[model samples]
Target chain A: MSQFLQFLFSGLTEGAVYAMVALGFTIIYNASDVVNFAQGEFVMLGGMVTFFANAAGIPLPLAALIAILVAVVAGLALNRFAIEPARGASVVNLIIITIGASIFIKGLAQLVFDKRFHRFPAFSGDDPIRVLDATILPQSLWVLFGACAIFSGLWLFFARTLVGKAITAVAANRLAAELVGISAKRMMALSFALSAAIGAIAGILITPISPTSVEVGTLLALKGFAGAMLGGMGNPLGAVAGGLIVGIVEKMSAGYVSTNYKDAVAFIIIILTLLVLPTGLFGKARVDRV
Target chain B: MLAREEASGPAWLSVEGLASHYGRIQALRDVALTIAKGEIVSLVGANGAGKTTLLRTISGVQPASAGRIVFEGEDITTLAATARVSRGIAQVPEGRQIFGPLSVADNLRMGAYLRKDGEIAVDMDRIYALFPILAGFRARPGGSLSGGQQQMLALGRALMSRPRLLLLDEPSMGLAPVIVDQIFAAIVRLKSEGMTIFLVEQNAFAALSIADRGYALETGSVILSGNARDLLADEKVKEAYLGI
Candidate 1:
């Protein structure tokens, strides 16, 4: 029973990261139809830049704040330089552009920071807290709390706020949003900023456990993309649910099956979900107008 | 562009020599139309008669291939759709393009997104009062609403913008007769409130009954235009558009 509890906690912590990344994917996908492959770079940037900033003697909170700011700006640049220029381009072209961006950021990270893995101290104390005979690290709690806070924030932003509704409007029908005076261009930029900020938060929270490296983004991006697909693209709630599902599945698979093939579990679930219910758990199938 | 400048002549909205196309197929050709302040003008036509194209071009969604669009005595032919919207032109597009995932209340708020006023809640209450059905379903996702209710939501959303000119496209499409009566009654109420409206409808007889004036558009050009009562009584209009 303790073993099961341990796996559940561990799964939730990892799932939080995927949930944040999936939320990031949802924002960009809603604002622009392009599925951004470079989304993982935001995570890398958050971890690496904060690591360097902390090394330079900055406080951890300040370093995290700076990392988030940098990620937002970088995300805006990605939208402006890469996404906007390729507007109306084929989906395959968008895929290439974002993938190319991911590679470019990875290369830039190697040039700017050392290739060695880096870690930051946990936000709170490093004491292990026991719940029902399951010991969990303090940092894991921080990650879980951060994920919950972000999800709540996004829910309020989309459901209650006017600007958020405009974003929702653009997501639903760009032409209609524009006809009602919502600037689709500005909304697009804001989506990228929001997406990157969410990714940065995920990175900052997980850096202690996961460590930071230039190449870390590739696998994280893939998993995050998978989670988003599993939840249904363009759905924020689905992103969170999908992230938790993937995380728990991977944890259970590693515990009961084979640790080496843990990653395969997420992919298998995604394939099955797509084959069975293509729109996903919380996603609605879009009705085609005749 | 030059034609747009001339169309800015002391009218709520004016268009001259307006042309639009979908690829090589021209949807609107040299279409000229105008609406006076506080007047309800209806553009009645059959499907494929370019009524929608004309409204879209005026709102800046479908750019004009040639000619000018002036709103409130200013040239807006070159502005983007959002910009035009901020200048007091709001459109309730055909098929009622409400955000399906959003709540009915949130959808209405999206209409007032550009407004800096703090009384959004007040405006929302006003919309609810106008369409009690929407108020009852304000918490429901827009997609959950029936077709007639969605049209009401769309029109209510457009009203949230406090637009000086409201352009409605085919508001009667796919609606039951009872709902159509409600929608038409709402238009009458709006007109009584001194709203300037440009209405496009395939239901020519119903539209003509509510309009102060009416224009007959065929293949993107106005073949006949006169007082609404006169157009309703015309033999050609009755045969071509009214299904008489």
Candidate 2:
């Protein structure tokens, strides 16, 4: 029973990180219809930049803030230099651009920070807290709660704020958004900044428990994309649910089936889910009432 | 070219040597027209006569290859579409594009996004008065409304911007005649209340009847311009546009 509980806690922590990444994917997707493959790089940037900044004697909180700002700048630059120029391109073309951006970001990360795995000290210390005979690290709780806070905060932002509604408007119909005086381009840039901030926060939270390297973004992006696909492309609640489920399933499969085959679980879930619900668990099916 | 009657006031908006292109195809060519304040100037055209493109260029959505658009004697030829909104230019696009997931009232509120005044609630009330059905669906998602109701919502949303000059494109499209009448009545009422309107439509007779002056566009150029009554009575306009 304790073993099961341990796996659950471990799964939740991993799920929290994936959830944030999936959310970042959903935000950009909704606002601009682009699946930002560079999302994982933002996460890596958060951890890698802060890890070095702290090494250079910057306080952890300040370093974390700097990392977030850096990620936001990167996000805006990505939109301005890459995404905006390629506006009206085919979906496949846009996806390839993002993939290219991810590679470019990965290269830059390796250049700035070496190819070494790095870990930051936990926010509340490295103490292990026991709950019902299951020991979970304090950092895991932080990751879980941070993700929850982000999700709720986004919910309010989208539901109750004017700027949020404008973003929603842009996603619904870009031409209409412009007719009403809302700049779809500005909204797209804002979406990028927002997703980057979320990705960075995820990176900062998860670095304590799991060591990050320059190349961590590739696998994290692939796995987080799987979670997004499992949830439904543009559904926030689905993204979170799908990510948590993905995490738990991977951990369970690793514990019970085979540790080496753990990574295959995401593909399997995707294949099975696709075979049944091709629109995803929460994806809204395209239905034209004409 | 017909001489514009500027008896009331100088032109509130003028499009001079306006041209727009879609790759190899030119959608508008040297299109020139003017709308005086308090005038309902309607542009009537066939399915592909560049009527929509002209409206789009004036709204700053479609790029103008060569030309200048002047609003209130200020050159806004290079202004972005978003800045044009705060400049009191609001457009109701061809299809009523309501944000589907937004509530009816929330959708209305989005029109007032650039407004810093405290009269938004008051303006919202005015919109509700114009379309009473929208008030009942205040909390419902905008997409759930029927086509005619969606049109009403779109108009209400544009009015929320409190625009001095309103550009409406094919407002009567896909709507029942009674609903069209209601919308036209609303437009006339808006005009009477000091709103400058530029109406683009395929319904020539209906458009000219409400308009003080009319311009007819063919392919991508203005083929005819005159008093609305004169165009309605013209043999060429009757055969080509009014289906006489």
TM-score of chain B of each: 0.94, 0.95
DockQ of 1: 0.49
- For A241-287, candidate 2 gives per-residue lDDT tens digits of 98898899999889978899888887887787788887678998643
Identify the leading candidate in terms of TM-score.
Answer: 2
Model 1 lDDT tens row, B133-165: 898898888978899999999998998888878
By lDDT, the best candidate is 2
List chain A TM-scores, every candidate, in order.
0.96, 0.97
Q: What fraction of correct interface contacts does each candidate retain?
A: 0.71, 0.59
Alpha-carbon lDDT of model 2: 0.90
In angstroms, the error of model 1 at A176 is: 2.0
Weakest lDDT window of 10 consecutive positions for candidate 1 chain B? B1-10
- Candidate 2: misplaced stretches above 4 Å? A286-290, B1-11
lDDT of 2 by residue, B16-53 (tens): 99999999799999899999888999999999999999
